[model samples]
Target: MTGSLQGETVLVVGRGSGIARAIVGAAAAEGAQVVAAGRNREALESAYKGTSVSVKGVDLTDEASIAALADDVGSVHHVVSTASARARGALGELSPEAILLSFHTKVVGPIMLAKHFAPEMPRTGSLVFFSGVAALEPDPGFLGVAATNGSVNVVIRSLAVELAPLRVNAISPGTVDTGAWDGLGEKKGAFLEKLSAANPARRLGTPEDIAQAVVFAMTNTFMTGVSLAVDGGQPLV
Candidate 1:
């Protein structure tokens, strides 16, 4: 419980983004053998570039794919999933397909992951799922995101109880400069500025911020059945 993961293996799903890359780097720095899993093999490999982290392809929405991934990986000391589907809209304005995909990505995917990978994890191992501040603030246009993330919070608690010694927890992050808003062009800066002003922390989160929280959750032996809000007081504001 007080030791490092020097010889442990960590499997990080959704390795194509800045946050996932940061988590991979942090874990590797902790001396854990890191495995990056994503739907795109090329992207996964590209994310690790010159690093020794191994890359694997796994579609979270597909049970068979996840099963195959678990089998191939054999055993792991921890699992962290950053995979998410972008689904945003008003209550009645959103497409059903989009809503379903959101559920698949944020909810069902983790469920399947636990089903397949939990058995491979030892009691000291943990599963860290990603949630978001939308679930806490309930923004008007992010009904789907709120629903999926809120459900994840509940799922983590339930899985913690059911999985017993295998810890299950969630991290809910606020708006971060993870390049997801890069498509907004010039407006991205203004958007982040507004977000920073609204949050008590007065700054947008960095991928490193969330990654460190994830490493804590993964390594902390006493934590489980809880959602740690890494939102920089965005929900309180």
Candidate 2:
């Protein structure tokens, strides 16, 4: 917790989330060199430019692109993914294309990072992925997202054991106010209120709230193979 991560390099995927940004900032503050990777090069640079961070724009679905990204990343101690794709639609209305799109981004994409980078991750570094509350607390229209997150969560957990020498973990955040749901603006408030009402905290979790946990997981050596929920007790409901 104290200077435990100095001089470590953390490769952060999906630098777009508020939570991801917070995590990057915290990691940098803690003396870890962070390289932010995502599809939006401009956005990542706009957000994290001029720092020690090196932002790379990449489409994780593309093997060559991800491989190039992994090559550029070189050796690192940690890989944290906040990258998620939106393919949400009603169940029957969801085509195989949409469902697969979500899975490719949320599950398959992170797996690619491990595929290419695990061999390079330092023994002490960890791999952390992100899941949404949707995975556990489902919504009828968000079936694709829920299922993908669930799969990714399990994949990361299982990988933790499989990649024994290397550590892996995931964070499931509840209703963090990120722009991911910008299209669902109207429904966002009403649904979140209803969901938050059931939790003892009586509020939705924030990105910074989740960031601290992510950093905690990176610094702690004992924790792995689990997707910790930062849901403000939403599970109790």
Candidate 3:
């Protein structure tokens, strides 16, 4: 790590595992004071125990919770949100509630975080949100997921323009072995193998892959309103 974020404070909003956990570790490795926040404050605290990361509670679906978190965290140099509610199912199996939850958690939540946290961040500060390859390479049984991620890819552009000197970007990941596919159960290994073969890189992604891209986005002042695809060229094929 170049310690590009040395002395800077980074706030990462998400659960205490998978990509979110990896992001926290990555930011800390870059010499930033990282805060791991989510709805489960206790879990975060426990997960990050014995580490430098601090834990806080914030519900993405609720504005009041976000505002309260902003008040608690006060000033921050960079903020990264990795929270997402995936509605994985075909059109017929999808419910209105699931779609709405996906949109609210992945799309609307990051926007609100920017709104409240922007006031406290400096001009050089950046905001990184999580998008996914589902948006770029649409697939069946993930319509809601695609729509939610697609919205994020667009919103960051508007946010960058509106926020000006404050950088806004997103990290779009492909099939990362962050245990997200664990729900696939017995088929998880075969599914990953198939994806790896199809991907141009001939491999599935990892949480560290996405986290490294996020660090780049946050530190590169020239980059904004862009969605960095750290999908190992999965979208290429």
Candidate 4:
């Protein structure tokens, strides 16, 4: 890290846990004034405890709420949205509401962020959106997740061109050991082990891995409209 972000302001949405929290810490360590935004105030507070990060509440599904956050945040040097609605099940078992909500959270929300925040972003500023490896290597029960994340790749490409000079890109991660897998309880470790053995890297990804990719996307002035996969070769095999 070259400390290139020093003295810049970075707004990281979805700071509840997992990769988002890691990103907040990494940005602050790089000397950025980090603003952590999420729907859960308590979670945000907990994740950013003892840090100088500012916390704010913003609901991705609500346009007015995102606009309000933009108004409050004012100008920013970069923005990254890790916000996602967790809705997964087999195709026949899933609900329409859950599927729609997933798209709204991952797809619509980022669009709204660009709609409102683009004007405030300088030519050198960038926007990074999070996608997932499931979009490339689909499984049986992750239909909605694959669809939503796949859409993000398309959205970022279009936005990069439309937004021009204000670089836009996406990061697609593989199975990472984030709190999102806590529901597996005692089986979480074994599950991760299985995935690790299958991956070419022979390990599950860490939040730090994803955070580093995000920082790279933000600072690489020559990169844009690209969906870089930090999946430890999960998509390859």
The candidate that achieves the highest TM-score relative to the unseen native structure:
3
- Residue-wise lDDT of candidate 2 within 5-100, one digit each (tens)? 699999888855588899888888888888899888899888875778888877877878889998887999999988877778887888898887
lDDT of 1 by residue, 1-237 (tens): 233678999999985678998988888888899999999999888767888999999999999999999999998989999999968867889998999999998899999999999997898999999999998997887898999999999999999999989999999999999887777789988989999998999999999999899989988899999999998999888
**Which 10-residue window of candidate 2 scores lowest in summed lDDT?**
176-185
lDDT string for model 4 (161-188, tens) is: 9999999999999999887888878998
lDDT (Cα) of model 3: 0.93
Regions of candidate 3 where Cα sits further than 4 Å from its true position: none
lDDT of 3 at 108: 93
Clashes of 2: 0
What TM-score quantifies how close candidate 3 is to the native fold? Answer: 0.98
| Colliding residue pairs in candidate 1 | none
Ranking by lDDT: 3, 4, 1, 2
Instruction: Give lDDT for model 1.
Output: 0.91
Output the worst ten-in-a-row residue range by lDDT, candidate 1.
1-10
lDDT, candidates in the order shown:
0.91, 0.84, 0.93, 0.92
Candidate 3, residue 220: lDDT? 93
lDDT tens readout by residue for model 3, 117-136 = 99889999999998999998
Cα lDDT for residue 183, model 4? 85
User: TM-scores of the models, in the given order?
Assistant: 0.96, 0.93, 0.98, 0.96
